[model samples]
Target chain A: MKKLVIRSLIIVAIALTAAFLTNLLRPEPLAWIAGAPYNIFSDCPETAQHALPLKIGNVERERDFFVDARKAAQFEAGRIPGAFSLPYDSLFPADAAKVDEIREAAGGWRIVVYGDMPGAKLLADDLFSQKAGNVYYLEGGLDAWLAAGYEVEK
Target chain B: MTPKKEKLKTILAAVGVPLRVYIGAVFIAASLFKIYEPYQFALSVATYQMAPLPLINIFALALPWVELVCGVLLIAGFWTRANALLISAMMLMFICVLSVALARGLQMSCGCFASQDAADEIGVHTLLRDFAWLAVSLYVLLFDDGRFGADGLLEKWRKSHA
Candidate 1:
């Protein structure tokens, strides 16, 4: 039993070594201890970085347009009222033409993109990179919207 | 040797090697993506809504490497019992997580393979698949005597040298 324990420890040591080595070679090395106070700014675009709270509230109604960065099915099920569907593709990186199409339709207003997960941030980042300066992603996606007592529009 | 023990050894020889290799190969394959994309894996783990935020990164950083080493050892047939035991424990953990997530109606990806964005969504099928793998690991732990693959070769060498 002692031998087994020793062998297991050896295996663990080897595994940790490999993980550390590979991580060192990565372009964006992960912080071993996460939840850093500034982690929100790490992947966010330069514009999003200055947004302070990062999460847009109250949908902005007629003044701002909402973009659903999730699938068409999810968008159709329920969404912020009068939101446009961009349906971010999970299988592929953000599509340039699809994002352009959404941008064109939004007419230079404040565009708030959202998804069930980080897809919204991904789309918002892409849009902001393409010079859509007014783009922002909803915090925590649709769930956050509902959590804050906001109504969904079927 | 007793007849029953002989039977067990034969069972190990016939089934254990192939099972170990297959499971080991799979684990190695699964770990490769997670190892390369730790940040994405961390996001996937977060979506499960189970692990505390502070520790999700730890699992993201370490679990893939553990899987890789165990897989390689299992395939080599070195420390066959230990490797099988570890695999069984991981499988049990996965089973419990999947069950709890399903019971609470969590809609998320399994993150079993590929990036979180490209992973198979969690569901009953994934649960059954994990259960199947767990059974294989249990079978190996119960039957393997380390008298095959690298372990057997090392033993034969030790006897001849002695």
Candidate 2:
């Protein structure tokens, strides 16, 4: 029993060492272990302030360009009127051309991205990181938008 | 032994070997994705909203390595029972998390494999699949006689030395 336990420990140690070595040798190690400091949602009040509720009155008053960051199918099913479809997953660093297209369309207009809350936030953050100016996200997403009786275009 | 009993044993042992291999292979395959994309896995874990913020990274970093080691050990037939128990525990933990997520109505990805997206919603199907794997792990824990592995050979060598 003791021998078995000892051998198990050794195997576990070896496996972990291999994983550690793999990470160490990688060009871009996993972000968490690489000790990269990330700004949590709470730390960025200025960014959070950019997130707007789906109140129809507020939305109607603003001249912001809304970007639907949901999946293609979801965007097609229904979205805010005049909102352009840009799936969040496709917004990779390699997709600079697509980002440029959105930026061009916005053309100094405030970009309001919305989908699912988490996904919208992520897309907004990605856009901010890429220096997309005046980007905001819709809090609580399309569900909230619908709940607030805002008209959606099919 | 009676012929009927002997036949039953033969059938069980045959089933056990393949099941062991299947479990080990699944673990290895699952671990590989997590190992390669620890950051994504961490994000996935965070989506569950069960673990605290600080511990999510720790779980993400260590879990794939544990899975890999146990998987290899199970395949090698070395410390088969212990490895099976470990696998079973992991399955149980997964089952609990999935169950809680379902009950809480948190629409998130299972995060089992590489790609996690809005479409990868958690449901009863994920729970059922993990439960099936859990049953297999428990079978290995109870019935693995160390046959068809290095453990059998080691035992043989020990007896000869004695």
Candidate 3:
């Protein structure tokens, strides 16, 4: 029994070590780890950007670095003027090429995102950690921008 | 030891993999639900009011990651013993939290299934469910039931190679 206990402890220690090393090697294991709690707390409607109202003029004085997190169909219908469209799920850190593309477009500028509200914030956090410049979320999403009478492209 | 005792141990070892898989899948679904809605999970943690704001936020954010990583490991049988132990520890934590809520008569959700349509409310059912899950986890911790796992296959391969 003592031997069995020791062996089990050793195996557990090795496994934890491997997990630590794996996370260390990967740039964004946080994406995988941080997802659980979010799914539990939100109702579907609350997650939508347009569902919640936003703070006014949250994107003033920002450069042309807005990324629309909504789907293509949503983006084509309407979006903040001069904002680039990069749907949320597409921004995984493993996709280095896409990250580079986003980095190049938003060069030396504040990158603001808004989907339906703060739904974009989690995506922005992941992108910012990957070195996207100065990421922000329009306090209220596209609806807020339109509500504030800001310029929007159809 | 008696023959029956030996036989039972063998049976437990044989059935370990399926049991582990069931537990792992549960954690995976639970964790994924929370991950898909992090802010909501954060709010749930805040509602508990046991920990301070900053601590609660960080815990709310990271706990799901632990569950996911460990759950995946458990499923893949990559690190069965470690993941089993980690899950057991997590179950104990949950039991503590659920017990407190029960004692206080706090009507809050257990936050176990983040994507559920129900509000964060707990009662006798939640407590019983958590205890049951905890029992299952404890059983896994005590037994290697690694039957269909990669860990079992690897061990077999190693013996053959040796």
Candidate 4:
């Protein structure tokens, strides 16, 4: 029995050593553990670093058109100077040509997108995938702009 | 020791060699891949969701080295019984972890073998595969097959003494 216990202990020790060493050799355990299946692990886009944050001081000149992808009432009350209204739900208007219209209006200039909630980033990624050129986010959206010394019309 | 007892020990030692060699070869292969692509292997380990966030990096660094050492000892035929038993224990632990993860309904990768090749989501299927390896190791304890090993020398000496 004593011998058996000794042997078992030794085995346990070696196994543990192997396990620890294997983990030591492995690099980024958190990412592996997170278990997100969809996001193909890819290098962060180089352009992401260069993309500027949108704000009122430069919202008009910097962006081709500021899209108030928020509720209609919110848009009517106040938005970036010279900004056009396009609520989130109404983006895919039945007309179908609205995509073209938005595209043409946003031609040759960056489109700054803002929304009322968190889905804004996903929408931005999708819009960028759909060939929206030089897209930027307002960092904190209109809320942040409002907090940072900018006035809303309403 | 009694003749029967001596004989049993000889048989146990004799059975251990080839088992160790085969297991060693596998460990070496596993170690090589992990050492070659440490970061990728770490990511796979993390995907398993077993270790805590802070310690994942440390485990990633240590596991490959352990495999290499254990592999080399098995291949060299040094410490045959001890290494065989060690490898067996490791396989048993793997089986347990795989089983628990499967039962929990967590979709993850096994990260047991050389690569997460497809990032093949580990499930009940992976648990069975690891159990198979554990069974092989347990079998080695009974029939070690240590023909070309240091343990074989001990077996020969015991035979002459009897």
Candidate 5:
């Protein structure tokens, strides 16, 4: 039993050594955990800025183009008037043609994305990364929008 | 030997090697992806929403190494019973997590042998598959005779030396 414990410890040590070596040698170091790239929400003026928070009043006053970045079912259930649906879950790095389409349609007008907080932030970051100008996100999503007495379009 | 006892021994002997190899190979293969892309594995672990946020990264970093060590030990037949117990314990944890996620209607990847995005979605099939692996681990714990392994050879060498 003592021998078995020692052998197991030796094997575990070898495994840990192998993992440490491989991670050290890899070209692109992985983040210790998964998260958005730190620079995605840059405060620097040279690069794109962090997503601006767009309130319901500003959305109504400006009549800016809105992009709903929720799931399809959520978008179908209710949304802001004249809002274009762009389900965030389906958008991948490789296939972002829909984003391009929305950019083209907006014609450089301010775009406001709203949905679940993380999804909204992700989509807003993606748009900013793609050089979309004047991108913003609705603070607190549809629930907040409704609470602020904004009308929903079915 | 009695006929029944002989038949039972024959069955165990015939099945033992394949079962150990299957469990070992599966664990090794599964550990490779988790070890290589630990950040992705962390994301998959987070999808379960069970672990506290601070520990997710720790769990992701350590779990794959444990799997790899146990897998190598199982294949070498060194400390076979202990390794089998570890593997069985992991499978039981997996079964519990999967059950909870399914009951809660959380649609996320199984994170079994792949990164979160690339892995198959968690469902009843995943639960069933884990249960099957758990059974295999238990069988290995009970009937492995240490044949065709370094453990048997080590014992022989020690006895001769003594």
Candidate 6:
């Protein structure tokens, strides 16, 4: 029993060492602590690009990086699968912090924002201005996504 | 030992080796791609909305290596029971995560192998697959006894020396 425990520990140590060493040599090593969440979201909508639900669905079929700009309550009710929630009336600290986390983690991915109102447009422009590349808004928001027969995560 | 008990041991000893190799190879295949792209794996983990953001990167970084080491050890049949237990635990964790993701209607890939954006999305089939692996791991954990492996050879050598 003692030998088994020791062997398991050794394996874990070796694995950790290999992982860290290989990661360190990468040209763009990932942050040890991702999204050090300590920023506020306050960007305004400017030049927000728009896309139809079908187009966005087709483009991001595999890795759909959607950002839901609906209210927290609405988001809780239902949302596009894998979509990140960043309700525009995000006066709460949690929502604001989420914006910060998304800004950091979304990285170079094609981020598509959607909502029933202009919140999606505003959030997309905000993210784009914040250097979030390839940011766009959904033409008809969740309704469009549903209309296109995509499942929602509730 | 009783005949029935001895017969059971013989059966387990016979089957354990192949099961270990199969599970080990699957694990090694699963880990390689994850190790190659920790960042994308992190994104996939985040998509689950399970782990906190701060922990996602580290989980992505360490998990693949854990899988790799356990896999290699299982294939080598060194500490076979321990490696099988580890694999079983990982499979259980995966099964639970997949269950929640599917229940919540998540549409992300399983991220078990290949890229995070692989066509194999999380679904009932993925859950069933993990459950199958978990069953194999449990069988190995219960019946493996240094047979057809380094452990078996070491035991033989020890008995001969004694």
lDDT of each: 0.74, 0.72, 0.63, 0.60, 0.72, 0.74
Error of 3 at B88 (Å): 1.5
* Alpha-carbon TM-score of each model against the true structure: 0.60, 0.57, 0.49, 0.46, 0.54, 0.61
Model 2 Cα shift for residue A113 (angstroms) = 13
TM-score of predicted chain A against the true chain A, for each candidate:
0.57, 0.59, 0.57, 0.52, 0.62, 0.56
True-structure RMSD, every candidate:
13.3, 13.2, 15.9, 15.5, 14.2, 12.4
Order of candidate numbers by DockQ, starting with the best:
6, 1, 2, 5, 4, 3
User: Which segments of model 4 are wrong by more than 4 Å?
Assistant: A1-154, B1-16, B108-118, B142-148, B154-162
lDDT of 6 by residue, B1-162 (tens): 999998889788779989999999999999998889887777667766788878888898999999999999899998888888789889999999888878988643321222334324667888888999999999999898757798888889999999
What residue runs in model 3 are displaced by over 4 Å at the alpha carbon?
Answer: A1-154, B1-6, B108-118
Docking class of 3: incorrect
Which 10 successive residues of model 3 chain B have the least lDDT summed? B108-117
Q: Candidate 4 lDDT, tens digit per residue, B43-106?
A: 6666666767666655555566666766786677655545566677778877876777677765
lDDT score for residue B103 of model 2: 96
Which candidate has the highest DockQ of all?
A: 6
How much is the lDDT of residue A4 in candidate 2? 51
Model 5 spans > 4 angstroms off: A1-154, B1-14, B109-119
Question: What CAPRI grade goes to candidate 2?
Answer: incorrect
lDDT of 6 at B83: 88
Model 6 regions lying over 4 Å from their true place:
A1-3, A36-49, A52-154, B2-4, B109-119
lDDT of 5 by residue, A1-154 (tens): 6764675566667766776666677787554554542211212212436566766655532436788988889888999887889878644741368777777766655678899988887887777677655578888888888898878997
Candidate 5, B31-109: lDDT as tens digits: 9889888777776786567877667766777779889888888888877777877788889998998898889986432
TM-scores for chain B, in order? 0.89, 0.87, 0.83, 0.72, 0.86, 0.89
Could you tell me the C-alpha RMSD of candidate 1 in Å? 13.3
The TM-score, computed over Cα atoms with residue i paired to residue i, of candidate 3 is: 0.49
